[model samples]
Target: MVTGALAAAGFAAGALLPPRPAFASEQLTIISWGGGYQDVQLRKSFFEPFTKATGIKITEDQWNGEVSKVRAMVQTNTVNWDVLDVGVGIGELCSHGLVETLNWNRLGLDRTKFLGDDKTLDCGVPHHASSTVIAYDRTKLKNGPKTIADFFDLQKFPGKRAMQKGPTSNLEWALVADGVLIKDVYKVLATPAGVDRAFKKLDTIKKDVIWWTAGTQPAQLLGNGQVVMSTAWSGSINNAVKESGLPLEIMWDAQMLSLDFWVIPKGARHLDEAYKFLAFGGSPKPQADMTRYGNNGPANKDAMALVDPTIGPNLTTSPAHMANSLEFDYSFWGDKRDELNQRFTAWVVQQ
Candidate 1:
């Protein structure tokens, strides 16, 4: 009955292509950022059930969040992926016709229920939301810092700190800590003086910060007592704590919340099945089930009531934690990604 309902919601099976196509009629291919976060979560919470319900064999693969590969596969007439897990570039790719456009009406997806408005999403189906927040070891700092300013203030909360090497969230956090309002972070970051101010604020703790490029590093550092607090991915910290019982707590103040969406590459092998997978993956129950094992906040607003309350408070989209967070500006990153990436890299090496 549920599968029948999803079919009505646009999950109708596609016409079986030739016997020797890129994927057989029974096989569906999916690409995502593998490892525990994407691999384990999707396999258990999404793929296994999807396969059970539809009897389609699913083959999962991983990528390093490189849209270039997706573009190449599509342009070369060798597109194999049915669905893609993407962070940024959804809009640009959609405009360039590199990814398929979404039909909310057909998918039975409620636009009003997703976290951000439709304009912010660029036609991708968001599975869950995660944020880069301050994660502290409660055992070490009983009275941990509450705001971005506290995270920056060396004297008030003195301890080793870890920050992602990139400047996306760091730049915004720096300005907010230096007295810029959370709402004005991007506005100030737009100005030359504001850029200087953010860099200078970062310089204050340059010596104190342990730069990390991988998502797992911050959680590991916190558990190993290498840093008292770290700017960590909310999901990664939650998983670490659940697996090992780490005394970690996340501070959601000024958090830069980001949504990971499922997109279909242009001319994907299985368009109907891809759409079906995305819609199924984001429905209330599946979204809620993901939170039971990991800290990812469900994209469906109606799904919150289904999540265990014990785990709800730790999710990035949880009401208690989400009120103080900011939706990351996807447009800003789309426009300035390269320029800022270069500047940030140079600044990091020079420091």
Candidate 2:
């Protein structure tokens, strides 16, 4: 009876119901980062099951300039996206009134079952967790710098090193290198002098370091031996290790941990269905399945135990890795992003 009622509601709302509630809605679309094997996992785990269960269709598009797209949609009053996966910095922008605040309870997901009793909230739910780790080619550097400080100490660990070019993570890394405690990251970065101090510290390594604009670029550089040391995404570095036989090691100490969220725009056509899909995607089983294929740990804390042990340890959000690292404060970064970006841009261009 519930299934029939849902099917009727879906038909009346012009929303295609997934054959089952466990499946995704028909004709749903997702916006995500382009490339990487994560999309493949999404297809096999989420999209396929969603289609099969609900008899709903799914499509995905790369979210290259999604902010602009969202803004345009807002201007035209015609939102096209049902779900979006945005970075922490981007999430800050959305939180300022761009995207809708999700109501987990209304969506029928037991928040406690997913994110735990304390962490689950109505605003946004984390989708994947990752870290910025130091990956070094073992053959090239016999004793590569093991910590972020050593990564910045070019004199001792002399070789081509690469760091992310953008303002997002670099400023925090720079502050970390400058002896600011990880817990005090944003507090230090909040001041003009502290911001300058970070840029000044980064200036020392600017000339010798290669600036990587894309995530895959760092992995490619590490694989080709173009750089002996670099800050790389955990999954990308792992891929390099497996595919290219690069004797790369990740230093977990002082790793910058981050979480990405699945968000909905304010005026999406399929809010009800989108919320249902979010809950389904956030479930433990599907999250574990996602990790197996893409090496990304799902956002659900409960899902951690379900992941295969072999891949689980390497995941950024895994218990072992999470213990050694600091969670990137999304609220802090979201708040101070523009100031940091402006300062970072000036520093990068000066290089």
Candidate 3:
């Protein structure tokens, strides 16, 4: 089964490329989950300019099960994907050994230019940052939850609240609920006992909360009044506020900040082209353009300067916004994710 999957991925990757002479101009394949507004901006701001500059033809393939595909490619040594965009958690896991270490200096890329410091540096470059925030329908709850802790405190902020079912943002929220300081979140989660305590706290509200698997779902529920207080993606919440015309407000305090990255798998076929794309993708202009179009903040700090002040204040990377929010520790979760997931899943089922 694994061999067949790898062969199929290789064929798919090859089939998407525009034929080019070997060792002349490289053909790079970018395996992304889907082309949302971000994809449109990438094409106009990054890909087109990159192709014109480097003479490299870039092709994109939509693959949802990214980790599986990357693993298959690595095992078969038939790596079809030269560039990939993945969540921060998965990016950290890949950095452990699954992906190639980026040569930033050789690519003329400076890490200091990005939003988060060199702490986010590794096998990939940070793409965009967003927050998991409490969004409440002003119509339903005149006084909504002001923080993540309030979102969990059903007694004070009584409502049918929605939260992500996955471990990505939940564990951090759980730790906060259990009275672990935000700065010491991962430090506590690093221990097996800390992981247990997080789940135990989650069990307390398991009956009152609705679990959402995807980012879009909770926002939809919020718009429809299916949920009054919920943890939602900042971008999705902004969309709901605009589309529904509801008096929905995001509580930025203690909001869990998350980031995504652009990565290259080990043994990729087009290393030079991929590096070119990464460096260009991380630049100020392209990053700013993407944020303007998608309402998602860029990882390039310089890009924030170019962003419109009206939209800038709401972005996760904004200085004002980042003040009250907490940066999620991807490294800690990446190391102990399997165990955390197993325990969280069992606890959810028991609830």
Clash count of each predicted structure: 0, 9, 0
- Per-residue C-alpha lDDT of model 2 across residues 220-280, encoded as one tens digit per residue: 7876888878888877877777787768888777777776667777788888767767877
By TM-score, how accurate is candidate 2? 0.85
Assess every candidate by TM-score: 0.87, 0.85, 0.87
Runs in model 2 with CA error above 4 Å? Answer: 1-26, 36-39, 110-122, 223-225
Worst 10 residues of 2 by lDDT: 113-122
Each candidate: what lDDT? Answer: 0.81, 0.72, 0.75
Candidate ranking (lDDT, best to worst): 1, 3, 2
- List residue ranges in candidate 3 displaced over 4 A: 1-24, 89-96, 115-120
Error of 2 at 88 (Å): 2.8
In order, what is each prediction's RMSD in angstroms?
Answer: 6.2, 5.1, 5.4
Candidate 1 global TM-score: 0.87
Model 2 residue-pair collision total: 9
lDDT of 1 by residue, 1-351 (tens): 874654443323322323322223655788888877666787888888877666566778888777788789888989988888887666556656788878887777787788754655556888888888999999989999989899999999887899999888999999989999878888998887998899999999988999998888998998899988999888788778888888899888988888888888889888888878878876888888888777788988999999998978778887878777777877677667788889888988885
